[model samples]
Target: MRIAVTGGTGFVGQALVSALLARGDEVWIISRKTAQDRTGQERLHYATWQQLEQNPALLEGTDCIVNLAGESINQRWSAKAKARILNSRTDAAARIAKLVGALRQKPATVVNASGISIYGTSDTKTFDESSPAHINDFLGSVVEQWEESARTIPAERLVLVRVSLVLGNRGGAFPLMSLPYRLFGGGRVGSGRQWMPWIHIEDMTRVLLFCIDNRDIAGPVNACAPQPVTTDQFGRAIGKAMRRPHWFPVPAFLLRTLLGEMSSLLLQGQRVLPAKLQQGGFDFRYPTIESAMENLVGKSSKPSV
Candidate 1:
């Protein structure tokens, strides 16, 4: 299979690219500059976004297109930062959609990455693939527009994976969340009641590949674990994994003052369930917070932790 990927150098994209290559799929990575270390790889190819923009034919014969290109959402959302965030995602989707439309034989599938933030902040609401809730916040708005841009991509199958907080080694949200735990300052954020839906990175990658292979899977598939935990529960799991005490508490006001609107990323969440993936017969390797933390952070040798 010949697959083209945008944002192929990012944390999740890197893993996805490697997984695709390991399975003998030829990969065309769209980036500003080709990775020097991957220079001599046989099945790996690279093209700048500019090159693809001038010549959409560069992606002809591509079997799948995985779009993950976007600016980082990890920092304070300054006016400029927020604009970049929105433009980055929607622009990539629009460009890819245009390219796919110009093709004589479009890709069979287009797997786009999204977030579960579309469900908004809800403690009482349990959202699945069928939920029609619309979140009115910054992150939520970004997700809504992101998916809309993806709708333009013409493919037999279009999979929009609504990702939760991804837990993994040296990637995703684990490193930042685990840092305080390692320093013995592990604490619950806000009221500790906000739902924390998360998934192991391995499972995340598997789900993406599952969508690629399973022709019937389409639309939004929640890429989260079966069991969702609260903020306090997540903190406890992190503490347990690092053999530390989860005793500190970071006030919501402090986060608001520090991060402003960006604090919503930490203060709000959804109780999302992967109902579609489960019904599709996909099994999660790390289904619980305990299991996920242990697998990613090395199980605490001392069970008492």
Candidate 2:
């Protein structure tokens, strides 16, 4: 299969690209980098957004296009940072939509990244793909706009992967998250009751592929494990996996002071279920928080996160 990916250099995108290339698939990376066509014995290619704007035919034969390009929301949520977060996501989706609209041969499928935050934070509520989006906070609002833009993409099948916290030892949040445990400081953050819907990086990649291959799957699909854990249980599992004590309790006020509005992501969260994935018979390799942490931490002495 020939696939085009935006943000192919990012953490998740790099992993996804590697997986695709391993299976002998042709991969076109659409980025801000210089354009490069397929070289001899190379299935990977590159095309800049500027080049694509000039010639939409660059990605004409691509079988699928995955839109994962967006500004990282990992920074301090300043006014400017917030604007970047929202605009970057919406802009990326709009660009993909425009590119698809200009395409002489539209891709069979488009897998756009969405967020579980669109369901809003909840202490006593469970959400699924069937649940309506609730824009209750900054992240929620950003994702709402993000998905709205993604909806405009011209594809036969559009799968909006409502990604949750993707946990991996080498990338994403797992490395830093496990740092405290490695230092024997694993503890509760904020109120510790916030729901944490997570999926292993491997499972995340599979979910994306499943969405692409499955003709019956469309619309919003939560890319999360069936067994979602609370923040407190999450820390405990990490501590146990690392042979550290989960005793320290970071106060909510400290997190609020330190992270400002961004702290709400840690202090409050929604319990999400991968209902669509489950109904479609998608099997998760790491179904539980315990299993996910063990696989992420138990491999190396000091794994690079």
| Per-candidate count of clashing residue pairs (backbone under 3 Å) | 0, 1
Residue pairs clashing, model 2? 170-305
lDDT of 1: 0.87
Each model's C-alpha lDDT?
0.87, 0.89
The alpha-carbon lDDT assigned to residue 279 of candidate 2 equals 97
Candidate 1's TM-score reads 0.95
What tens digits encode model 2's per-residue C-alpha lDDT throughout 177-223?
A: 88988888879998888999999888998898898789999999999
Rate residue 206 of model 2 by lDDT: 88
RMSD of 2: 2.1
In Å, residue 164's CA in model 1 sits off its true spot by 0.8
Best by lDDT: 2
Model 1 stretches astray by more than 4 angstroms: 37-39, 299-305
